[model samples]
Target chain A: MHTLTDAALVGVVLASFLALGTSRLTSCIRATAIQGWLLALLSVAIHEWPPTGHTFFIAAVSLVMKGILIPILLERAIRQASVRREVEPFIGYASSLVLGGILVVTAFGIAGRLPLPHQTSSTLLVPTALSTLMIGLLLLVSRTKALNQVVGYLVAENGIFIFGMSLTREVPLLIEAGILLDVFVGVFVMGIVMYQINQEFDRLDTRNLNLLKD
Target chain B: MLRLLVLAPAAAGALAFLLRANAHRLALLVAVALLHAGLVLGTWTALPPADLDGHLALDALGQLFLTLLSVLFVPVSAYACAYLSHDTGRPNRTFVGCLLFFLSAMTLVTLSQSLGLLWVAVEATTLASAPLIYHHRSPRALEATWKYLVICSVGIALALLGTFFLAMAASDPRSGATPLLLPELVLLARAHALSIPWLRGGFVLLLIGYGTKMGLAPLHTWLPDAHSEAPSPASALLSGALLNCAFLGILRVLHVCVAADQAAFAQDLLVVLGLGSMGVAAAFILKQPDYKRMLAYSSVEHMGILALGVGLGGAGVFGALFHAVNHSLTKALLFLAAGNLLLAYQSKSVSDVTGALRRLPLTGVLFLAGFFAITGTPPFGMFLSEFTILSVAATHGRYLVATLYVGFLAMVFIGMGNIVLRMVQGDAPAPAASGHGPPSSHAPSPAAASRESWFLTAPPCCLAAAALLLGVWMPPGVHAALDRAVAAVAG
Candidate 1:
């Protein structure tokens, strides 16, 4: 049996797409949680055959930090902000989907030229990683709300983490753990800033920050 | 030894936190900065032989940058004591502590031997300096600090992702092995150069990521706010030193690409980014409202010029190196001098403040002198170094980029000139006409205006003097070092 690890990554990518295309914020967050679970599983499997125990520790942290904790924190922020609307975005949903589609094609096209190791299970891993990354960028750029952008950044980190996971043996699992810790701090900081923005402006719109222009 | 550079300041920072003696902490701050600078200079001059944990090393590039940060920071750090004398914060200790921590972070950035370590260092610099930028706690300063942290943190995260890709590049050939050390990678790249196409992609991401921090085009939105809203001494550190650390990160990646024989591809991307930044600056400088922000945009322009020179290759690299030093010194002088004008007039808007010379003679004179020096007028190091870059550009066949560069620079000159001339030469307006916004007003008293402190004036004077000295005479030994730095890039 190939185990549920590979199947879980496939499910994660699908959930990542659903998160991108989802209209409701809560559902998107749920999809992101699923992606986090898939990532945690992926991280755990790296040590099973290779016996790199740091991988197991990192997977545990990812599960605790990303899957369970971050969603709860984001959900709490949402309740505090009380912003439940899909809200008007810079770009409409259809165009965002189109742009995200183009980005996915471009990512795989770019990845096709790289010299992949022959023995690797999925040379498509890099392309999928890049596609998810591009989708995160899409979400960030298309959104008008501050909270959505924070979610976008978290999703971007998830894409990068999954990408780095594929190179587990080469990158010393310790560095990956450090990377996750840094991302955790980044999200925590952004969340705090978003709260401040809400308190100051009485709304979640980030476009109102145009006061600094020359 | 390398660890001491970090630990000394860190220990001083903690002590400043606990001791609660402002005057004693200020003295300790200067002593620590001097001692740290001395350590960096001592190691650089002697070529001290040590590398901690192979994750940090003093290569030729690091040595050169280490020496620059050391020599340049000594005066700025000393001036900070007098600069912060005006800040009304209760725990003056936090600012002092952050200053030391900021220095430690910058030193780490210079000495980091691994790419990942360098990312950590650069990000730490961001964290350490955020509070320093918000030292005044004014609304404007708070806004600038928030923007700085959020933008820089995101940029750094993108850079971290690029590092992940670089690790993947190494993984393709070897499994469970590839230590993330620069020396090994550089050597490995030279031999297995064919497998590095993926690394080229990584470099593009790396350049864009670091370039955002370096205030290159399209991504340089945070720079003008952060620079203008920050204290003059902090602006000096940001322009003179911090930008260089980010540039050094890009240089390391460029070196890796060079070792892989992939330099040509990277150079094109840099040239485009560089020229694009200059173009954006020229477009905006024509109607710049705030004097400090105008200077900040000018900084963005100068960074573009540095990148353009680097992209040109050959003697262009030499000129770029020289220009980097010139730009740092002159830009610091300009910003510090601008600070004087801002204080005297109680406004940074060009339209609101007039007749700087009639109101505040010392600041007005320094402002004029600073403007001339920065705009590459005669008898300043900026002029000489900019000439070097132009000549190198002409000598190479980049005549089109050369012409466009000169054209855009001239436009910036006329644009900035109209503002500076109007602001500094006419009659002073009535005090009622002063655009002193309440809640953030800092109108200086006549006594303060009449007696400009030697502390403030001395730093700008020394910086301006260095620019003049470089223009008139560059000693052969210093020239030789710059030549070596240039040759290292070109080779």
Candidate 2:
């Protein structure tokens, strides 16, 4: 079980890198979907065999919503917007990959110094979560397309979910469900707004969204 | 009873989405608003028991915010009814439904007794209000909605991590307490059973996360745009009610910090952010071109003042609580009046509308009064609260904070005075003098546009009177409630 959890954690990190290096919007969306599936697997792998109903419920919901449902929504958005490549990223793909690599190193260094109250099954959990979070933030700031930014937000959310699931054992089932519901609705709302933007501006680049300012 | 306060509106909001007639939807919105207000008032006399095993309860602090939210909704709903009648370019089904859901979510924020539940409720407010901000369907409205949704969602994601850290801090083997329950965590923290490093880290993340929603500087990029672009009634609720709900989240975290003897560290960070927000607001207000945007910045400034007062502690906390009430009343009044001006003149530019007093007498007077009240001028409730914070700062010998506080207040007053006086005192433009502007898609007909209805003017008039009354006298019950709320934090 411990070895499986460690492999899933590593898979999460590699998926984030794939997302950062890709310029095709569809490829970026696929990378996030793969990360979501890995997160769902980690949810079950971190627990004992024949996991309890609570853990099983969370895993099933996340797998279906994050891995399957949200990807369909993003594909529809891009299909309607009719724009593919990331055209003009603020930071080029090559440099973003390098920065993502540096972020992983820093995450390991910081995780080594921090103290946790409880022992986890794997030592790699905290560092992997931290690295994923940093890379998500990097994608958010370096990308110009609205669709890319939404992908960045999902990556960041998945990172937080890993940290919460591993670190705290006492979180209630209801609160976890509420958190998942909020993220689903948040993405749904953002997709609708992206469609409207595509209709009004005839493009998905957020650079054109510069009308109101001080 | 507490469940009723939250669930009733949510169910009604769903029902509203299915209704087709505009009048029936409007009636449902106003009916829910009145019913929520009455339920809240009943709590003042007979407080409800904690429901869901203490996850939902109304403490002194919760009661204060819930009351403020309920009271403010009444006038805003009435104003929306009047305002929507004049401009009928689009269907308002989504607008009405989202407003009720927004109310339900904010009420949950007030009543939530566990940290995890509080985070859920606050995030829900962001999702609910996104559609409200995009009601106009214009390109600019869509831009503001997108910014509001993305920035707030990312900031809130960080807060979720912070909540986990706090749970980790509370999970000591010796304590055996539930992780995120407020009462249990506060008791554990006071006993020094929690980890200090984890507690401090969690508090900082929570501040940034919730502070982003609260419109603190450096994270307030989406506030002005969302506020100015949304229709007037939604703007009023966003400024008056929604911001306070975010502040309540921070205050809940601050309550736990106080019990852990970490108040000094938390207070210092709040004061810096508070002062920085004020400085940013002062700079932008000095040459603001749009009046609605000017009011939006003023909300930022008042939020800063609330943060500063709470950061000062003791008497300052009391002042901050009082200021929260005054700011809500005055800001809502100003936004509604601004809505009137937008309808009459068909512009938000400061240079576009002049001699408002001659054109629309009632709305013009209320606008001027709201300006004075919001700027902390005399005989307004804000003056009393601002003075309380200033005196406490001086007595504590924090001369730098005190000087900066006064300086920002003066700059805001000057900036607003110039723009407002010009708009209110000059002669009416030739086109406006005849009670009309150029016919546009959204603007009302020439005859109905300029004539101020009783529905439009009465709500703001009532708000202005409430602000004035609060300035002069505090009823005994309210005074006691304020003191209890202050003790809940200062202890």
Candidate 3:
């Protein structure tokens, strides 16, 4: 179980790096979706064998919402918006990948110093979660396309979910459901707004969204 | 009963989306607003039982904010009726539906006792109000909505992480799981059962998260754009009710911090952010071109003061609560009146509007008075609250903070005075051709512009009267409630 959880956590980190390295918007979305699936797996693997109904329910919701529903929403947004590449990202993909690597190392360093009250199934969980969160924020700021930013947001949420898996017992199932529901609705709202941006601005580039300055 | 306050508006909102006629939707909006307000009033007389196994309950702090939200929605609903009536071009279904959902979400924010639940409710507000900000459907409004949505969602996502961290902080290997309930966490903190580093880190994240929603400086990038671009009634609700709900979120965390003896740590951060917001507002307000944007910056400024007041942590907390009430009434008044001016001028530019007093007498007077009230001029409730905060700073010998507080307030007053005085005092501008300004399909006819409907004028009048009444006489009931709320936080 520990080894499986470690592999899933590492997979989540690799998926985030893949998201950063790719300029193709669909590829980026797919990477995040993979990261989401890995997180859902971690949610279950962090628990003992034959996970309880509540654990299964949470893992199922995370798998369906994070891995499946949100990615589909983004893909449709991409098809409608008709933009494929991230095209002239504020920070180039190579540099973003380098920054992503640095973020992972930094996450390990920071996680070492932090204390947790309860034991975790794997030591990699905290660093992986932190790295994913930082990479997501890096993608969010470095990308020019609004769709890419949404992808970044999803990655960051995935990172948070990994962190949350450790606290599965402490947090009530109802609150977890509410949190998942909010993320779904938030992404749904963003997809609708992206459609409007395409209709109004004729492009999804956030650089064009600069009209409302000081 | 607590559940009803949230669910009623949510159900009404769904019904609003289905209702075809604009008149029926507007009537339904007014009815729901009144109903929500009636329920909130009932809570003041007899506090409701906690629902969801104590996850949802109204404490003094929540009750104060809930009441404020309920009261503000009444006038805003009336104003929206009048405001939307003139513009029939766009469908009102989304606008009406979203407004009710916004109400429901805000009600939930006030009632939520679980940190996780509060985080969800606050995030829900961001999603619900995003569409409302895009109601104009102009490119700029679209820009504002996108910025509001993306920035707030990311900020809220951090808050979710913070909530998880807080749960971790409360967790104990010796004991079983600890639910993220506020009262339980406070008890744990008091017992020293929580991890301090985790608690501190979690508080900071929650502060930044909710502070983003509350329009605190540095994190307040989305506020001015959304407030300036959104329709008047929506802006009023956003400024008046929504910011307070976010502040309530922070106060809840701060409540736990106080119990943990981490008050100074949290309060120090509040003071820094509060001062930074004021300075940002002062700089922007001094040269603002758009009147609505200027009002938006002033909100940033007031949000700063509220933060600073709570950071001061004694009588200052009381002042912050009082100021929250005053700021809501006054800001709502200003935004609603600004809407009236927008109708008359068909522009938000300070240069485009002149002699508003002559164009719309009641709205102009209210607008001018609201400026004074918000600037902390004498005989307004804001003045008293601002004075209390200032005096608290002085007595604490925090002369630098006190000086900066007065200086920022003075700078804001002068900056707003220049723009507002110019707009109100000059001869009326010739009604420009409607196409000259931003493309607003809802621009009223010249006749409608000149004639101020009782619908639009009366709401601001009532708000202004409330501000004035509170300034002079704090009803004993409200005073007691404010004291109880202050105790909840400052103790």
The two-chain DockQ for each candidate, comma-separated, is: 0.36, 0.78, 0.78
Where does model 2 exceed 4 Å of error?
B174-176, B432-439
lDDT of 3 at A31: 93
List model 1 lDDT by residue over B238-284, tens digit each: 88888888988888877777777887888888888889899898888
Model 1 Cα RMSD, 1 decimal: 3.1
Q: Show where candidate 3 strays beyond 4 Å.
A: B432-435, B438-440
Taking every candidate in turn, the Cα RMSD to the unseen true structure, in Å, is 3.1, 1.3, 1.2
TM-score of each: 0.91, 0.98, 0.99
lDDT of 2 by residue, B117-181 (tens): 99999999999999999998888899999999999999989898888888888877555556899
Model 1 chain B weakest lDDT span, ten residues long: B438-447
Interface RMSD of 2: 1.2
Error of 1 at A21 (Å): 4.5
Chain B structural similarity as TM-score, candidate 3: 0.98
Clash count for candidate 1 is: 1
Model 2 CAPRI rating: medium
